[model samples]
Target: MSEHQPLSVDGQPQQLNQDEATQLAEELKQQIRNGVIPAGDSDSIERMVAGLGDPRGLMRLTFAESLGVVGKAAVPSLCRALSEHDSVTVRRAAAKTLTLIEDPRALPVLLKALLNDPDPVVQGSAVGAMAAVGAEAIDGLLEVLINPNSTAMQLGLASWGLAFVGARAPEALRNAATSDHAEIRCAAIAALGDQIQSLDDSEARGLVEQGLKDSDRDVRAEAATLLGKLHNPAWAAPLLEPMLNDPEGQVRKNAALSLMKLQATASRPALDVRLSQEDQTDVQAVLKLAINQLDQAG
Candidate 1:
């Protein structure tokens, strides 16, 4: 390979030997810093995108950051490479690069990669991009959450996206909280925790109350965990107190831990009662801890 390989020609990736790639990547970074190709200069942009495939980890990161600086002008090419690149390395880099750019135009490509990419890293990068895109990407994330065909990994990523953007999408989170799928409900409830924390939104808090009663034990446990993070004993403590006797031991345990987090001294009596009757050794330990913590707080 040449000592100084040219970037991709006509948007086609050309193989570059490691040394040539390093030199070319540094040159491109300099050009980007000097504002050479930010106007979507086709050749320069394609070269920058191609640099995402650099075999050197540091070079690849440098190229991704530079492409991010190129901003919206780089979205189209990045999207194409993310969806079509034969190299998983290129595809992964492209998705991660879009996360820094955070242009809404890349959401479609990111969503497709999240759902269809064979590589887990590529799929996760797509989720990160959608999250960075913020509110505009909420509906798409919710769509994945509700789709029965969505894999556990995909569902997990989409749920993460929802939590990340929850404050910006309260209405969407509310709708998702009522979803037929337990997984969707669990995700929505968790995201609502974000909404409650960020906005102190009353409606989001109400939905979390519903989550505590969800048919799925996991969802109920998730709801119990969400309440502990709210830091509002007046509201959260009352909600969690009743959960001490929940049929599910995990739910009861989470309720005790949450009460501990709240320092809900008022709930110590309830904790004391549960501790004596608690059959599960783990729940008993958690109840004792909550009571002890509350006693110390008082």
Candidate 2:
């Protein structure tokens, strides 16, 4: 096909070969730069979606970005490609493009893909698109996190999406942190950590502190991990130094790592004490590292 070949033929969308796809993408980009948006008509949208299957990596990315510029007008076609398309490449590209579009109208389809898609890449991309949708995606992502039947991988992705959108939904995440379900609580603690990191949210910090005392070991561990990642040594060091006494070895190990990250030099005495008493070799090793790091920090 010629570089100037039309996107459609005889009222239907036509597939672009590599050269044709590259040329079309470049022309569309130039038009965008010149303040002209591409047409979002049915044929035009389908032609761009079709380009998502191009074997050339860069061509597919160009088409996805150009479709992103088409905005909500391209949502229906991209959703169809993500949920119904036979090609995994097309499905992945459709999800990625929708991430850039970030329209709430695509939420239901993206949620379905995240929950039911057989391909790991497709599922991951769908959740990433949900993350980009921001606050509007919180409820759907939490629903997945709360489902008992959700796989570990699904739970992890939902937690990740929840964290990505946490700053926008602090009240919602705060409510979720008090949930009756441990899974929900765990995810919420992680989300609240994200809120703390981005906003230095005092309320979120308080909640994470409460999480350190949760009945569930996973919840306590997550809380410890979260505080370790936050760089406020004065606040985090005092909170984390005591977690070395946590019953779960993972929690204790994570606490040591976080102390190391914060350069909590004052915790050297605590680390030395923990190292002498830690039964888990892994925790003992991390406590030693924390002590070594603190000595260097001094």
What's the alpha carbon RMSD for model 1?
6.5
For residue 92, model 2's alpha carbon misses the true position, in angstroms, by: 1.5
| Model 2 per-residue lDDT tens digits across residues 1-298 | 0122221112333467878777888888888889898888988888898899899898898789889889988888888888877889999999999999988878888888999989889989999999998777887898898777888888889988988777776887888899898888898998786678777788888889999899999999999888877778999989998899999998998899999989889888888889888889888888888888888889
Give the poorly placed runs of model 1, Cα more than 4 Å off.
Answer: 1-12, 18-27, 39-41, 146-153, 295-298
**Candidate 1, 175-213: lDDT as tens digits:** 878888787788888878667777778888788998988
- Each model's backbone clash number: 0, 0
List TM-scores for all candidates, in order. Answer: 0.81, 0.83
Q: Global lDDT for candidate 1?
A: 0.84
Candidate 2 TM-score, true structure as reference: 0.83
lDDT, candidate 2, equals 0.85
